[model samples]
Target: MTARALSARSLLRWLSLLALAAGCHVAPIAAQELIAHPSAEIATLTRNEARLYFTLRLKTWPNGRLAKVFVLPDNHPIHQRFTNEILGLYPYQLRRVWDRQIFSGTGQAPITVDDEQEMIQRVATTPGAIGYAAVPNEHPDLRVLQVR
Candidate 1:
């Protein structure tokens, strides 16, 4: 092959490899869903309202019940997905909001569960409780909240 032809082929091969590498690192869109106790009076929330609940800014349900919030640890994959995909916020931003609330003595952080199982159990048993998980419908005791 001519030297020019060889160089062009090499460049094409490098570009193909680079594109594959970039595609491998791209994150898949998460499928996390917001869940609540089966008895929770609220069925749907605006995205802003859901954000407020997770941030500890909104304290009560529309039915006048205290809104109990549960969460997985900050570093858990499901928690990260929930914060990023559902709430449209990073985990650190949520932590900062909670920390400020605690330091200011005006609010408290959500109850942190160990894993998805515990998250489901807590939300199912705790009245007015809300949380997020993958496939929340699998548990009949938990209600999936629609975020509009």
Candidate 2:
């Protein structure tokens, strides 16, 4: 490679690295403060806890009342990620499990809702219920559970 060409490439590489570092440094400060906000104080859940909570595998709350769950549509990316991250299963696998439960007549799968507002409304009205959303809706009756 020619000397001038090599020097130009090196300068570009250094500039890219510096820009990346600056971006990395700036991004976390905003995220950290947002996460620390008072209303966002819901507890972080373990993978198992999140799974059981959402799947209704934990049929009842610690208080013994039957637990209900609400979920977003299967096609949604966030729902897919939530299922994979919490249950260690894809949406199809989770749906199959629910299908089996329906066939067995032992228990029902959690209800799936169209959007966060509907989910929040359902969970708020239903006793021992849980659901998730990007930003929680303003509902006096609903409780938002935090998952780390």
Candidate 3:
């Protein structure tokens, strides 16, 4: 083959490999659902409202009951996915908000659970509690909130 043709072929091969490598590093966001205690009384929330709840800004349910927020650890995969997909924020940004609230004495961070199982359990039992987790069909006591 001609030298020019050989160079173009090599360049195309490298670009293809580069694209594949980049694709492999991109992790797909998992399906996450917003779950709450059966008694929470909230059926739907806007994405902004959900962000407020998780960030500890919205303190009370619409019915005036205190809103108890639960969350998985900051580094957990589900937590990351929920923050990115539902809340449209990075995990560290959420953490910064929580830490600032905790340090300023004006707010309290959400209760952090160790895993999705614990998240489901806490939200199920805590009155007015809300959290996010993988599709929670196994637990009938948890209410899946619709996020607009």
Mind sharing the TM-score for model 3?
Answer: 0.78
Cα deviation of 21, candidate 3, in Å? 34
Alpha-carbon local distance difference test for all models? 0.83, 0.60, 0.83
Off by over 4 Å in 1: 1-29
**Cα lDDT of model 2 by residue, 1-148, tens digit:** 3686568658856776887978853222111110111232234556576676655566655556666667888998657756654455679977877788788997679788997567666766676666665552456665544444
Q: How many residue pairs clash in each candidate?
A: 0, 0, 0
Estimate the overall C-alpha local distance difference test score of candidate 1: 0.83
Q: Candidate 1 lDDT, tens digit per residue, 1-148?
A: 3586568658856776787888854222465789998667777899899999888788888887888999999999888888866776789999999999989998999998999888888898999999988863678788888877
In the range 86-148, model 3's lDDT, one tens digit per residue, is 887889999999999999998899998898888888888888999988764568788888887
The C-alpha RMSD in Å for every predicted model, in order, reads 11.7, 11.1, 11.4
Query: In model 2, which residue pairs have backbone atoms overlapping below 3 Å?
Result: none
Question: How big is the positional error of residue 50 in model 1, measured in Å on the Cα after superposition?
Answer: 0.3
